[model samples]
Target: MSVSSAIPTAILTGFLGAGKTSLLNSLLKDPMLANACVVINEFGEVGIDHLLVEKSDENIIELANGCLCCTIRGDLINTLTDLLARRDAGSIKAFDRVVIETTGLADPAPVLHALVRDEFLLNRLRLEGVITVVDAVNGWATLDAHPEAIKQVAVADRIVLTKLDLLHGVEGEDKMFAIIGRLRKLNPTARLLATHRGEATAERLFNMGLFDAAKKTPQVQAWLNDEALSKVHRHHHDVSRHDAHIRSFSLRDERAISPEGLEVFFAMLAAHHGENLLRMKGVIKLADEPDKPLAVHAVQHVFHPPLRLASWPDGKAETRLVFIVRDIPKQVIEELFSAFTDQLQGDAMTDKTLSLSRT
Candidate 1:
């Protein structure tokens, strides 16, 4: 693949004062991200981070229009379109990947929706993953008080616990771990990493194949072995009447899904539950193409066009989808899938019989 095709876009999101800019600076210093194009959104009038980022020239675009969550969708689309046009025209060195650093107080759902819903953009761009930075010191309090913080964590494919160095050998260490444990419950599918001075490896932060990004391995039957999910599930079960605001669930079935049917189902789901659906990632077995599996990943409502892997990593044929949702019943999603499979089964049978008779 070419450089443009090789690169993957990532969204950096977190609540106010969660160290998003610091993380961005760290990423920019890394040689791995040298070919990155950054989009920065400032919540206030003065944009200081643009000055902080050591860009070569004109690669970093700042959207001073408004907060990304509310009023900058047009600017974002236009900026991205222009960026792509310049890249294709060979005006600038072809960028490997694009990174959008959202405002600290921004809600990422709307931003994601705009990226995935646009017809022209969706074909060219792919949502690699969402990286949410959580302040190790104030994370618990922030999640408890701010709905935006909850949404940030909920939609993340990878969660980075920042400011760990500040808590060294102090009482805050235990508190930070406990907070991370709680966040694990909120988003078990997302890999959790501890970052010092906002520094981390690209391999640890990205390429999460909806399974184990850190391990670079597929989790099929091992999904049940994820300690984060089990620990959180137990905690929720222990406190049944507590704040049931956010719930995480994993659904796996042996049936293979058709690519067309999967597309329609995802489009419908995104339209209906754009706000409620936080993060979704899954590895699917397609009925028509059993030799290759489809990998589906989405942050909020934006989905990367399904990627077809050469072969299943571990020879497992099951389709597994993990969802981190807010106030959305697990049964609703389950029923939707059940209905889709039933309808598709009928069509599959007809196609199979027709093919057999022709042969």
Candidate 2:
């Protein structure tokens, strides 16, 4: 299939009891998601019948809104391949997009790897973004106890704050803001929305890749959120103990980076610190292609082959990279890039450092 025809897929992930299923059910109710298909992956052997739908096949369910609901039978790849085959055979409804709801404890990186690195699925499905559901009431405690929860927020493109209604009075208000601050420190670039206020709509959650859904234009700036990250970096005091390990930062270079330099930097990064690098998205100014900047994305060591945009989205010729990492220092990344491009100027190359100062 052609790249344009590849179905956009979004992964919905969060910690155990973070309300991932509830948020997904709410999203599926929207008429805008009528053409969307959902692949639910539960932890155990027996899948939970949590979705509000009628069972049509053994594993496939037919939603009233014309959406298909299927549980992962063996693995994600097999389920997706089967869905595509059935769609091609006119055995099932054709879906414009796919939403994979992973088990609460699941790390979204491996799931992202399948969609990105898989040879066949690469041409068929495009990973649009990751929507992580954060429970406002218990989110603070959960993040403190579970490192998985921190990773979920770190890699998210859109974080939906759920269960805010339970956080009522002045004390609750204080708690709510504290958790929000922690989430921002972990991933400042991700768009944070509250589900209780009706903000987590299909319009805001999906199609969060490189382009705006309605305008069909590149929303590079919105996707990168470099400006917002910079703002959060200014105030790094009172770092939370839970979020001390997870860091979000940005790196920028005014000079055009050589193709070889860019490649070596990524290689060294993936080789040494790939495990800590949770998520990365950037717009690069290649020395050879000055006018057409390359848009790049990576989940850990796996990177989506860079796409050449028609022109710079923000009309800027500089390279900007935003990272949500665990225990990876800003200086280490800066030195790696400097070694390649000879553009390192000590701490000047580091645009924003959200890493914990103490630990």
Candidate 3:
């Protein structure tokens, strides 16, 4: 398959009982994901989501209702390979996209690795994005206790906060804001949207990568959320205790930097602190092309190649890097990146530091 023709795949993940299956059901009801295939991976030998889904077939359930729902029979790679064969043979519907719903306990890295490292799937499929469903009612407690939940929030490309109705006028009202604040701190760059009973439109959740879906222009500002960089709001003491290990912050610099310098900084970051570097993404100001900011992103040690946009998104011409790290301090990243670029002055970084100070 040609590069452009590669199927766009989105991984939908969240902690256990985070309403992933409910969101999948809601999305399947809509025409937004028409001709899309789904791979449901549950924890045990017997999958639950496939049974929960109202489908006809067990292996390759082709529903005119909307998308194709396929339960994982073997490993994910084998399952994807099998789906491709079915599509090629006209046994099932031809799908332009694939959405993989992982079990709540699964870590996304290995799953992404399966896609990235697979030879057959690499040319035939492309990772469209990762969408994480956050259960607002129990999400705070989940994050506090589960490392899996924290990782889910960190690596998410887009976060959907579900169960908002449960928080209305309840004593857990403060907990709702607390969850939002925690999500922002864990992944400030990810676009956070609210949903009720998994009612969020499929279109809004998908198609959020380096570029905006409509114009394919760089979406630096939209995903990066510069406003998040301006302040790190504090959560209640109970909330704080849950996510003491995970830290989120932004490093900013108005000065334009050379690509070579940025590459060096990137190398240093991944080499020195790959594991602690949970997720990092942002657009940077380049001296030669000030208007065309460069987009960079990484999950752990896997770094996507830098993309230079045609123009700034929404005219927010500034260099900002949003980072979600574990056991790594904000000052450590600022000093390391600045040391390589020589673009951040001590006082300038200090000023930005003040903006990110815990409230």
Candidate 4:
């Protein structure tokens, strides 16, 4: 389904004690997000975030601002499907958007995979983007110690830096700057927003998907963020060796690729190196229809059905892919892509030559 046709769903995640609840509370109260339905996922048996709202027996809470909140009972798919059913039946307030708050220790890839790959969810919901909350005071230490914390930052579209208000004096300022530098290294494409003095607001966080909410048009450049990725790649050595395990990079090709070649490339990547791939998103210029670029997305091994745009957003007909991965070398992916696409081009030329000889 095209992104514009589905509900824009945002995933809110953070490390332990990163103040995700504070951000969620603030976001839910925003007038722009008044029609949003939130699904809160907690690690343990008892979920705490939803308790802040007025409770109901069915684990669903109705906020005074016309927002709805529900805790995941067993399966996330079940929870979302139920919400859709309720809205359609007029049993619940219809929500135009969804904000899913994941547990502190959760890996967000699975949640994204479900949203993109699920047959039912794909038609009803579109992945808006990931909003990761980072605690500025302890963020550097947390990232160093926990891989989950690092992954959260790596896959974020927007990184919210919390606890800046608590920082004081020159030492605190230095520490804050250092953390921001590290965040840029981990994920340069994500927009870093400080929550100090109420800077991080709903206006800055949502509707960052394939289509811009305000314009109702494709925002390919913003969604791809290739410019930021390219800048990071230029200063690749500036990133610490300790951070070598996780890296973000972009690949571009001016040549159009056949449908078969594209299939083989993705299949091999997923089957062999899926675990290392954190997230992949790109716009492809297909050989069959070069003008109608195809937007592709994948989380780990699962991929979203490619959506064809009406036209290239920037009027530049080229293929560009951005990847956030763990322990997957850029050279490896580049070689694999080249082998399939180039070989297919050669075969096509040879067939054309054979047809000319017969004529």
Instruction: Please list all clashing residue pairs in model 2, or write none if there are none.
Output: none
Candidate 3 TM-score over all chains jointly: 0.79
Per-candidate RMSD, Å: 7.4, 4.9, 5.7, 5.5
Off by over 4 Å in 1: 1-6, 43-74, 168-170, 197-199, 209-233, 237-243, 258-264, 299-304, 342-359
Query: Model 2, residue 339: what's the lDDT?
Result: 58
State which candidate, 1 or 2, has the greater lDDT.
2
What is candidate 4's lDDT per residue for 216-297, written digit by digit as tens?
3356668888889767634454345446588888888888888987887788788878888888988988999999888888
Global lDDT of each candidate: 0.66, 0.81, 0.75, 0.81
lDDT of 3 by residue, 80-162 (tens): 99999989998888898899988889888777767766778877886767899999999988987888888888888889999
In angstroms, the error of model 4 at 74 is 0.9
| Candidate closer to the true structure by TM-score (higher is better), 2 or 3 | 2
Between candidates 1 and 4, the TM-score winner:
4
lDDT tens readout by residue for model 1, 1-359: 32134446678899888877677666665666666666667434224355443333433342222111111344788877777777789866677667777887888876776676776677677566788989988887888778788888877778888887778665876887788777877777677777774346676675543322223335432332233455554454334422357888877777876777677668767777756677777777787888777777675667756666666657777777778876777777776665556564677644643332222
TM-score of each: 0.77, 0.90, 0.79, 0.89
- lDDT agreement of model 2 with the native: 0.81
**Sorted by TM-score, highest first, which candidate order results?**
2, 4, 3, 1
Q: Which should have the higher TM-score, number 1 or number 2?
A: 2
Q: Model 4: residues >4 Å from true position, as ranges?
A: 43-55, 211-218, 233-242, 345-359
